[model samples]
Target: MNRRHARRQGMIALALTGAMIALAGCAPEPDVQPTPTPTDSAVVPYDGPVVFVGDELESFLLTPAEVAEAIPEATGVMNASAVLEQVSDGGGTAAVPAICDALFAEQSLGSVGARVTRWMTPSDPEYGQGRVEVLQFADEQQARDRMDQLLQAAADCGQFTKEAPVTFDAEILDEVDGVRAFAGTLLDIDGGYDWRVFQAYAAVGNVVVMLNQPFTGDRTYDAQAAASLLQQRAGDARDALVADLTENPPVPEEQPVTDAAQPWSEWAIGVDGVGPVLLGDAVDVAVAAAGGTATPPTFDRGPWIVENPEATASMLIQQAEDAETVWYVTVGTRRGESAETPQDGAALPALGDVRVGMPVSEAFAALPGGTIVDVASSGEDYYAVTTREGRLFRFDTEGDAADGTAIIIGITVEDATQRASLRFG
Candidate 1:
């Protein structure tokens, strides 16, 4: 495996190992309630809706507009599910099993509502990027419980090693107020660069907050800056939740469920230039559709990598040697200082007409039979839509819900979890 791929796999393995030790209940359980502290005055009884709608976060977290203002050129937002599914650059075989086991476990915040917005510089997209995730729990106690579990897990797995000589060291930083923070570093012995991450977790009544800032370059990362930012943002979120509760008192009654069926629209799945294509199309046809010149498939008995150098897009087409059919196709964009150059206003080559940069509202409007089965937002009126056909689309809007047009930032066909292994080899 290449150095990049090895490093990613190693980092994932280390995380999973730590999570396993933590989830195994290796540490003794402490008192569920935190010690009596000054911050206790800040806790407020949550009376808002228990079942959360993504946009409700605007009452407590930073809006998309706010994030864009802070970091211009910020791409669209990603909901909680999308964040969990974000794997490292190189697809590693060993990391997948571990990530699935730990990240998807029953108590791993899957029950709560969450969303993440990422920020990266135009010059160095890979290194100087950060993410903020807000998780809303049923109540304060549950959030605290989850935090405790994460702390225990971090303690049990201090350091570990994985294949490709990758070593990971995790440290539990000092706690602030009642919140806990941690830092981790991953180093590839043969690779030139290292990956560093700083995370802070705080529980404010029913809202649980997490701040993750990752740097993947040669320079020394500023741990203090990362921690301070986390503290500030977490504090802001906590205070906002409290103020919202006091200002807008919620009716202490359960929300009634609606039984009316939503209208459905039929969608044509194809890239604008690349007409409709299925999961198993040949590499050349798929590449041409993506606005790239076709090249002969090079088989080393593995997935073929196709690139549209001009469009800054690439695809990984997987198929077995014995079978004439393709198993799955994964497409992505290269973003960095030395990344590929694309024409102005060119759409990403993943799904053609429905690719990134398309307006979310316009994309949905084009689908005659598409029904929004689920919708989530992370402030700024951004939303993640799930269709009845299992396709996932994320949109980032510019203004108020009534007038703002939602731009498409992400799309996933079929089951994203199984995208890597859709068919047997």
Candidate 2:
């Protein structure tokens, strides 16, 4: 939540929100479309077949006409993901389910390919939202395992609590063409009626299709109809995926820039670079170094935070306050009595001088005071300061500054040096 950084929209937030509050009866959609941006003129030419997980998945997705066919009240259906720039730090959750804390628990496990199609009926007032998620597992057996997990969870997920009481129950309605349908009800925690919910799933080969749509109002959840639709779509996607695999087309395998044989990746976290990323790298380059995504420090594209789930460290990258292009990368770390702890991506201590799990004073001592550039007062207290030597970092301490045991909780090795001279004009 850096004041200077524009937070990326909460992807979990809804375009459905405006539609839900629309006046009763269908109406023309609000001007929810974004002012279009420049399209990349670089559409690389490719011969033969391409992988179905990315650009190809769109064709396999339910068409706008198809969704409109189901939720006839829908006024306009746009590519929610492509059109809307959401603020992820803002509150609101997705139709994302972890039903009974079992289904969708480990999203990454056995996942070979995945894609989502989100369509918002932004003027429907009801039945204007749904997500079609296609996930390819390692094999057919794995796909079935996911299906089994969901079914079992549904059986035991009669009730659960998420900040309040919720009652989610479902029953097998039908299974046609290998697609299983579940007609369910979602009861509001405030003792409301059981709202209808539709869940359709189908597994073909190594791929799985999940169509989840909540029955908001006049548009009821139809398990049978949805199941039939999913069965056909899943079968098609699976076939395409298999065909691609057989053709063995060489799609650019996404690899972190850090995975390359560069010494900078192992170098200390300095103004030059942090892990696989470097100071002033553009969004695309930094994203590549972060295993394909640089998580926003608070869900915004600006001030991107890169983390390695396998380790205990993280880094932040941000543009200069008012300029474009990335300015610098920061490694949030702490001082340590011992350097035994692991880092988020790279080896700790940033050249053995400053490392997380170390003492705050020691870190600051190595890189002394400078001009304060930013302040963090929410949830923590710290100062982001810059130095004449082209260094910017934040040190959040515990207890009094004099106490040796006051371990640092959050430390950032940021930079504002190079950005000071940007041509912001």
Candidate 3:
């Protein structure tokens, strides 16, 4: 027999041995399904507020469009339910059966509900994979306990010799706040493949977010890069969940505004000699006004760049090809040991008298006549303020609201109503 056939035969022999052991009480049954529990009794009613009520997994889960943004070469997204069904039908390895048993065991996840999404490239049939699994629990404590269980399970199952001579090597990557990250490799001897996997777990309020990426290819995959990406994605997901839950929980109807608010269109920033610029202005006019040249378009977009001769200030502009208007402008102070102000006549772009480094309160006071519609935390110490006029300002605070100062860091102007509708509703 050929070497490949001989290897398959050997794997079959091992699998049979594993199956016999499993039947003899060494492993749990693969087909044991989780018992259905009443949704209300399963989880305690989130007492404070609800960003997501019921099982709207689609809203919190990363969509295929987002996956495309993260993994540019992603070909398609697979319905996680279908993938799970396939895994079930395949009658996975002996170890997999036991793992599922532990996962779905009574109270293991504490009234938890899960939804998964997977992104795949053309090569995924043989290698490469991306997936995000979100588990919503009864409370923050439950989510934390579940994460602990998952990490311990990974540690316990360090390696499996049955069914394909598989081996796992795992290491703790990082633990920030309540989030834990782990990275490892899976060696499949029978399949002739080595999979590099990175996993991150975070408990945000009453939810647990898990992001995992597994890749296999001819070229060596960088584990550090994969771990970093997983950590970033996990952190972003956790922040979004917390923001949604705490700031704008689900309500039956729109909350009435008690104070008068002005539109954001009145705000303007200087673009060099072009006088003042507002949202929806054409890209060429804005670039010329800023005394900068636009680069050739690629992927239907171009960037207008500006740099200070004295290395004190810089700006980057992005414009879309389908629209004549400039999209967004990012103005920032120069990095390193340089002094704050630009030399000679160079001046940093300004929204009225406000620029980066201005106190958060001062920036709002400088605005012509807009009301602070909402203030929400995006991540740890980072805050975003939205105005009635389609303007969003971001700031970083030292820590506490009373003792620490909030410094303006970035600003963006967009259609406020549309943005709110998409995010909150």
- For each candidate, give its TM-score against the true structure: 0.38, 0.39, 0.34
CA-lDDT, candidates in order: 0.42, 0.48, 0.45
What are the per-model C-alpha RMSD values against the true structure? 26.9, 27.2, 29.6
Sort all candidates by TM-score, best to worst. Answer: 2, 1, 3
Q: Which stretches of candidate 2 lie over 4 Å from their true place?
A: 1-52, 80-114, 120-128, 135-144, 155-185, 188-196, 205-208, 215-219, 249-262, 265-425
Highest lDDT among the candidates is held by which one? 2
Worst 10 residues of 3 by lDDT: 416-425
In the range 1-425, model 3's lDDT, one tens digit per residue, is 44565555556667789765444443333454689886654433334522222234334455677555545556668764301111112233445424422222222122223456777766656655677766544445545555666566556656654455555556656666545655455555574545454444444444555655555553234444444555565566556655665554443322222111221122234322112333456767666555432343444454555554445554545564356676555454212212333422124544555655665566445542222211122222323333322233333333422222555544433322221100000
Decoy 2 TM-score against native: 0.39
How far residue 333's Cα lies from its native spot in candidate 3, in Å, is 64
Q: For residues 110-173, what per-residue lDDT tens digits would candidate 2 score against the true structure? A: 3433456666656544556766666544344555666766666667667765434566556564
Give the per-residue lDDT of model 1 (tens digit) for 1-425: 44565555556666789775454434343345656765536655655433223444434445556444433444564432323222223323342223321211223232234555566545456656666666545445555555665555455434433333443344566766555555444444443445444444444444455555454454344444444445555656555654665666554322122221211011223321122324455645544444444334454545545555454544444453455445444343211111233322243343334555556566545443222222222233333433212233333333332232644433433221122211211
Rate residue 14 of model 1 by lDDT. Answer: 67
